[model samples]
Target: MTKFIIALAYKLETSIKYKRFKEFTYNLLENNSYPYKKHFDTAMIFLVLSTIGILIFEVNHKNLRILNDYELFAVIIFVIEYIGRLWISSDMHKIILDDYEKYQLLNKKYKITKSIKKIISKKVDFILSPMAIVDLLAILPYYRPLRLLRILLIFRLFKILRYANSLKEFLQVFKERKFELFTLGLLYITVVFFSSTVIFLYEGPEGVNPNIVDFFDAVYWSIITISTVGYGDVTPITIEGKLVTLVLVVSSFLVIAFGTSIITTGLSDRMEIIKENRVQSETSKMQDFVIVCGFGMMGRYFCEELLSIGKKFIIIDNDKEIVNSAKSLNYLAIHSDATNMQTLEMMGINKGANSVVALTNDDAVNLSIVLSARAINENIKIISRVNNGNSRKKFDIAGVNQTIIFNDVAAFVASEYLGQPVAFEAIDGILLNKDFDVIIDEVEILDNSKILGKDINLVDFKNYNLTLLGIINLSNMNNFIFNPTNINYTVQKDDILIIIGFKASISQLKSDLINLDFRV
Candidate 1:
């Protein structure tokens, strides 16, 4: 039953829709695996059920006497949760593993327990602190009627949500735009205070309710008029008050509009800075990275594949705004034309990079980049994207290791629509290289082989799915024999066979055909 309850709790935490809720539950579970998450989950269930039971009791007031016992039960459950937190906190020595480091090598039992204590002790305060206060408040019912405030106990849910990315973004916006928001808030306060004070002084003597005759009323009126939400409960009846109201209303509108424009502009600039920082930071940390010349649809897919394999790369585009947008996601991007020699240098082409993938939409620009990169580092591999078949030959000669023809791919896709699966297969075979597997192996003839004098065909090839394409005879000083017929093929000691087949079948065939006597 305990195990079942634990499974249900794990599912609830992991499967929660709210990112904040999920993060909260995950942290709680990770931090205090022994009992913290279980205790919290149990406590919450009890609180929710008790609150609902109380509400039902309130609805049927005549039967409130019957439900009187639940109030104490609810309080007891909360107190137990609170005590459990304290007890778990006190067991700090058991949870921490670091204390073991302080002991001498021979004292294994002492060190282990000490480490456990240290880990638990360090985290105890974090688990018990604000949450304990919330737990305490949740169960304290001052009055049966005032039990509605117990609903505010649900605000504890905010603690979990506060760690969410959305909340972090919200907090970050305020942190980044602190001065601007602070200035706006100050102005709003001043407008409210002054307008309310004037109206209070002006409207007080005219028999308008003195209790509502303060600066707050005038401030309320100002907000309503400025926002155009005029609730109409309060009004400036006196001539002096009316004059003040007129000035306040017009000035308030102007201030609001001006403030909004300033704030919006400030936020946009901050966001841009954030994006640029993201890109620079992301790129600066990458090593042996591929520098992609564009971030178009094809370039994006290429980047995604590199990222999937955990390979590092950076993007370069001509648009500053586009580059900055990529930066905000913490992706490395440079805003520059790929064809420029200076742009290539700036991307560290001369050092610290393995390859460059030119993906510009412009064919001529991509060709120029390939030529420029080859001149900079002839050893650097260049993959150039070509839009048409006409440019493939020229790009290949310009030292482009691979040239992708976008049009050819598009033609194949179009052929698929026309019901040509063979064309699709051919396209896939060319692009993905799916037809055959290339295996490079150094095979040495063993003394136990049966076909020492016999031709190569005497060795069974069909059973192993093997095809011997060539041989390198070390005895004749590393001469390569390509497609040698069975009569010419003679098994010699230390002969290396280069073969191709399906990868698995090739492994089995190699094992059957050759055995290494010794490996250096």
Candidate 2:
């Protein structure tokens, strides 16, 4: 039974792209980027307000025609949003796009179209899954008026929230410690059942609401009280019944506390394992990725830099808590000592990394990573973070690519903050933290844009207050001309301009490019 619960949680989390959907939702909240950002926010707000409004209408004597209408509108919008989410889900190709290419890989050797069809055709179970049943019930069109049953629709939020990393961790822990939870749950049930049976026999005839003529009513009241929810609709009038109720209430609290503790410990352990597995899986598939061996303040800065430039990287750390934290931020991270060769290999360090940044506070651990990496793949670039500036040359002699002394970098940047305002601000915003006013936009030149025929130098970028960081083309996405001196390169259609500027400025630039006159 515990295994079943854990399996369900696993399917909802690791098997689905729930994490990405949360990110997509967050990205949707960004000021500019996607098409449906504003509409999405509007729908969310409407849903919240509508739910509260209708719930009040149901409970109190509030006039609810306007509220009902709004709730209906919100539900309709939510249906559309839900469908869109399903379509955009990672397995969406299987759900809707039934094309041969859907099953075909980049390499033709791994074709599983036949296997996929066979599995889909042979499906037997339909009504067993609670979530599947919930999805079916939510769209059944039977709950037009506000009903208690309709409130179950709120469970749809879990369909989305289950994908979130923190939620996923909770689910994982619940599963890993299901057996203990189940045992405690059984004990709770026994206590409730025994108490209810005794109450029904002892004092049911004397209560005001003696609906406990049968065993079921006694059981229901016991469940309600044990769950710490006394609705006041049912109560005991007899002294014997009231005494039993008091004991049940106190025992319920103790049972709940015990169960919570068990779940917390189970979740912590399972979360660490899940986090490690997630990082390893992601890193295994990544190519030309950077391996960051630590998640300290410095490692976070390094990650933000890579994220700004849209580089692939995985973080490795010995601290399980830090690794889990990184995982929650949607970063791939392994909770293992970076000095270990096995940990490095598991992270695909030997096979796919373009570079490895050893940034753990301990100089010995960082050097060990450099030495181990050198042994595994001498060609792989190693950037070691040095605590003591004097150990820089030793790491250099040990084949480390670059030794960064963080204190010196911080001091230099701090000093420059006074002398060079723009450069310092830009550096601080893009490097130190992710919550900043800067964005990296990759704009493609359309055939109709006026800049297409003009030379890069003559584009009047000075008036626009923008800078061209690099140019990328159809052939290569990574290779870019960074700080190119020559500006005579003619822009063409489909050429990608990797530019960094204030988001508003870039948005205006894109709008201006779209409005440019062209005769073709």
Query: Global lDDT of each model?
Result: 0.66, 0.71
On the 0 to 100 scale, the lDDT of residue 65 in model 2 is 86
Total residue pair clashes for candidate 2: 2
Please give the range of 10 consecutive residues that has the lowest summed lDDT in model 2.
92-101
Q: What lDDT does candidate 2 reach at residue 250?
A: 88
lDDT of 1 by residue, 42-85 (tens): 55565555666666557657646546666566667557655545
Per-residue lDDT of 123-199 in model 2, one digit per residue for the tens?
Answer: 32323345445544555433656555666656555444323445656776666777887899799989988889878
- The per-prediction tally of clashing pairs is 12, 2
* Candidate 2's TM-score: 0.44
Q: Tell me each candidate's TM-score.
A: 0.41, 0.44
RMSD of 2: 13.7
